[model samples]
Target: MTPATSNGWLLETRGLTKRFGGLVAVDGLPLAVRPGEVRGLIGPNGSGKTTTVNLLSGLYRADAGEIELRGERIDRLRPHEVSARGVARTFQTPKVFGNMTVLENVLLPALAALDRGGHRPRSEILEHARGLLEVVTLDRQRHALAKELSGGQSMLLQIARGLMVRPIHLFLMDEPFAGVHPTIKDIIMETILRMNRAEGVTFLIVSHEMATLRRLCERVSVMHEGKLIAEGSFEEIANHAVVLEAYLGR
Candidate 1:
């Protein structure tokens, strides 16, 4: 099946496929993400969730498939090119500049946006960066070095960096709640919901936390062995026999 898009969806994939030598990591996957939806992608280990994210973010090229964003073809684009086209992503592990200050870590992406021919002034960039730090509740630690932050703080810093890019329409996040404290997790969850509601940022979140997914997502897709097996509301999927079998290794 080919992932089809319509007026409402922000992204679409048609027969997306990828392989490592003889092993197929993603097999003819078809998926679509609607604008303003917190879509969840969940599956057991080795289910190809990470691989699908890599392919969507342009970190890996599909062997045979098509990808589209907002009605334009994007499968042929490079990672930076995809970023330029209003797509942003975060990794399983947070990536922050250890040597840079907290504010500086977030400011770099704004500079990159300027470098890409955006006409915003330096003052605008700085102001926006500071606002992001405040949004992530790191304003007081603006001058602190990234290395000084806790694990959860590092995760917030990573997200702040991604938003510096102008006109970001889609965000692909992998395991944003992996090792953080419960309070920090609440903050992360709140931030995501705020962005989605206030900024209209669409998200494709890959996480193992089913409870979080239930709270955060309106729809969830289940992948097993590189193929999407079931998709629906959380309530429906939780009771699905196929989902049960896949999780239990039946």
Candidate 2:
């Protein structure tokens, strides 16, 4: 469902398109995400969900169109520049620094951002890192090496690391619950909800979990063959005849 607001979207894309070689990965994708809103993106394999994420995250340059964050144009920013502009993302596979301690991996982004801002105090950075670890419930594992953590813990670490930048918008989560234990999945989901509620972080999540998406997302966008096929509330899209036929391979 659209949030009750007039012209108050936090992120919007106008005719976003991307292509590679002879393939059109995404085509004329128009979407809007309000502040603190959770929007789900779903589609069958090769439907361009990941490609859309890549374009939004600045990992891939758009072949056409623009992206606006809080109404500021940001489609041309580099990936790191995008992060600095209050956009952060977590990959489908956790990319923890295996050689570093759990705390170090989480601390990297905060420290880097701070250093770039001309802050060079080690004690201050350490303290900030500790706080982030606490936020993700990883303070107890502060000294543990990244590679030693379980899959769920790794996912938590990835999210915690993303938050270290204090992003206003987040994108690029794919199959977040994949291969994680049920309890850990619950923890991850709870953390996501808490971030949105308490910090006003906007999210564009990509996943195949219909039940989870229906429960968490205010709006759902479905893609097919690199084009947006449906856009509506979860119930509206879930009950759509086209969606059923697409999912059931009819």
Best by TM-score: 1
Off by over 4 Å in 1: 1-6
lDDT of 2 at 104: 88
Error of 2 at 71 (Å): 0.7
Candidate 1: lDDT of 236? 92
Model 2 lDDT tens row, 1-250 = 2242456887788999998889988998888877777889998888898888888888899999999877788899998788887787888788889989998898887777776783547787678678767776889999999999998889888887777665456645767777888887887788788878877777788889888877789898998878888889987997888877777787
TM-scores of all predicted structures: 0.94, 0.91
Model 2 error, position 62 (Å): 0.7
- Encode model 1's per-residue lDDT on 105-164: one tens digit a residue: 888876876787878899988998888888888899999999999999998888888777
**Cα lDDT for residue 141, model 2?**
94
Please identify model 2 stretches exceeding 4 Å from their true place.
1-6, 118-125
Q: Could you tell me which residue pairs clash in candidate 1?
A: none
For model 1, state the Cα shift of residue 177 in Å: 0.4
Q: What is the lDDT of candidate 1?
A: 0.87
